[model samples]
Target chain A: MSAPGAVVAAPEGLHDREFGPANAGKVGMWIYLVTDAMTFGGLLIAYASLRRMGNWPDPAEELGITISSVATFILICSSVSMVMAIRGAEMANRKALLGWLGATIAGGVIFLGIQYYEYNHLVHHGLGFTTMEHGNNLFGSTFYAITGFHGLHVLSGVIYLTVIWIKSLNGRYDGDASHVEIVGLFWHFVDLIWILVFTFIYLL
Target chain B: MSEQSHSTKPYLLVWIALAVLTGIEIWAAIAFDGTAKWATLVALAVAKAGAVGWWFMHLKSEYGWLKFVAILPIIAAAYAALLMAEVVAR
Candidate 1:
C-alpha cells in the first residue's frame, strides 16, 4: 500500500507504458509524411515553373513512356500488396503478412531497376543534366531532379519495407500492426507521388 | 484497431481501376496537345493518386486528424500554383 502523498512508483517491468494516444505512432508518421509532402511538392512545383517558363524539350524525343508506364503499374500493384499485408496483420495471419510484404518490396526494387535503365538510356542518348540534345539546359536538370528525388524515396521505401518484411517473418509485430500500417502509409504515398511525377515529367 | 478483417476484394478492385486509369493517362498524353491535354493529364493523375491514397493507404478509415494533415499538400499546391504564375508573369 503506497502511503498518501507518496509518489507511487510502478514495479520494475511494468513501469513502461505507451506515452501517447493509441495511434500516436501513426500520427507521428503522418506528421513526417506531411513534411515530406512539402519537400516533394516544392520540387514538383519548381519543375512546373521551369517547364512553364523555359523552352522545355519534347519528352517524347528522349524519354520512354512504355517502360515507365509499366513501372507505374508495378507500383500500384505493390500498394495493393501493402494493403493486403496490413489486413493480414490485423488478422494475425503471418503467412499473408510475409507474402504481401515480400511482394511490395519486390515491386519497389523493380521500379528502381526500370528507373535505372531509363536514366542510363537517357544519358546514353545525350541527355545529361548539363547536356541535352535540345539547346535548353533547364529541361534535363528539372527532369532529373524531380524524378531522381522520387527515385531516392522509392529506394528508401524498399529498404524500409524490407525490414518490416523480415520482422514479420520473425513474428515480431504479432497481434499488432501499427508499424506495418505506418509503412503502408509511406508506400502508398510514394506510389501517389509517382503518379504525379509520371504525368508531369513523362506525360506532360 | 479494425473490428473486422479486410478481404482482398477491395484491393483487387482498386488495382483494376488504377491500371485502367494509367492506360487512359498514356493515351491522353500521346493524343492531346496544349492546355486541354495538360488538364486531362492532371485530372487523371489526381484520380489515380486519390485511389491509391484512399484505398491502398486506408486513409479513408484513418483518424480525422490524420486526414487533416492533407492540408500540408494543399499548401504545397498553392505554393506551386503561385510560383508558377509568378514565373509565367515574369
Candidate 2:
C-alpha cells in the first residue's frame, strides 16, 4: 500500500529514479524479513512465558545445549559463506562465487547433520514427539513445536540454497548477479531466525 | 561495492562471539538454578541476538528507519505470543 522507497518526499523525485525495481526487490525482501522476525518472536515469547510459568526442569537436564551450539556455529558460518558468495557475485568473479556458494551449501549440510544428531539424541533420551516421558509435560510440547518448526525452516532453507548453488554452477547468475543478492537476503533471514532459535530453544 | 568496502572481520568476530555466548549460556543453565539461571540465559540471548542482528545481518549498518521497520513486527509478534501463552496457561 505504501509507495516504494518514498517514505519521505525528496525534492526532485530522487527516489522515483534512484529506486526502481531492483530497489523494490530489496525493500520487499526487508518487508518479508519483518514478517519473519514476527514469526520467530512469537515462538520465542511462547518459550519464555512457558518457561516462566511452569516448574519444568532446566534445558540442560533434558536437552544438551553444547551439541546445539555446534549446529548454531555451523549456521553462523553459513551466513559468512553466504556473504562471501554475494561478494564474489558482485565482483563478477564467477569462480569465486561458485566456490563460496559451494561452501555455503556445505555449511547447510553440516547444520542439517547436526540437527539430525540432536533429534536422535533427544529420541534416545526419551524425548520424542509422542513419548509421555517428554510429551506428557507442557515443556516437551512447546519445546518440540518451536524447535521442530525452526528445524523445518532450516531444511527448507537448505533446499533453497541448494538450488541457488546449482544455478551458480551453471552460470545462471552471470548477467545481473542481482539474484545472488536476493538469495543472500533470504539466506540472512534464515540465519537471523536461527540466532533466535539458538537462544530460546537451546541456549536460553 | 559498498559491501566490499566494509570489512568482513567484524562479522566474523560477531559470529565467534555468538558461539562463545551460546557456550556460556549452556554452562550457566547447567550451573545456576532458579531465577538466576533464567536471568543469565535471557541476558545472554538478548546480547547474542543483538550481535547477529547488528553485524551478521547488517541491520545496524542499514538505515535507521529500516531497522525500526524490521523490529516493529517482531515486537508485535512477541506480544501476541505472550497473550497466547497466558491463555494456554490458564
* Per-residue accuracy of model 2 over A1-204 as CA lDDT, tens digit each: 433433232335344343323355566778887887777676767666766665766566578777777777788788888877877876777887888888887887888788788888777877766553743476767777877777777777778878877877766665445667667777777776776676666655
Error of 1 at A136 (Å): 1.5
Q: For residues A153-200, could you state the per-residue lDDT of candidate 1 as single tens digits?
A: 999999999888887787766667778888998999999999999988
Looking at every candidate separately, what fraction of the true A–B Cα contacts under 8 Å does it contain? 0.79, 0.43
Which candidate should be chosen as best, given DockQ against the real structure? 1
Interface RMSD of 1: 3.7
Residue B68 error for model 1, in Å? Answer: 1.1
User: How far out, in Å, is residue A103 in model 1?
Assistant: 0.7
Write candidate 2's Cα lDDT for B9-84 as tens digits. 6766776787788778778867887669768986887677667667655676566456667678757955775786
TM-score of chain A of 2: 0.83
DockQ of each: 0.57, 0.40
Candidate 1 chain A has its poorest 10 consecutive residues by lDDT at A13-22
RMSD of each: 6.3, 5.4
Which residue window of length 10 is worst by lDDT in model 2 chain B?
B56-65
Regions of model 2 farther than 4 Å from truth: A1-22, A52-55, A174-177, B1-6, B77-90
Which pairs clash (backbone N, Cα, C closer than 3 Å) in model 2? none
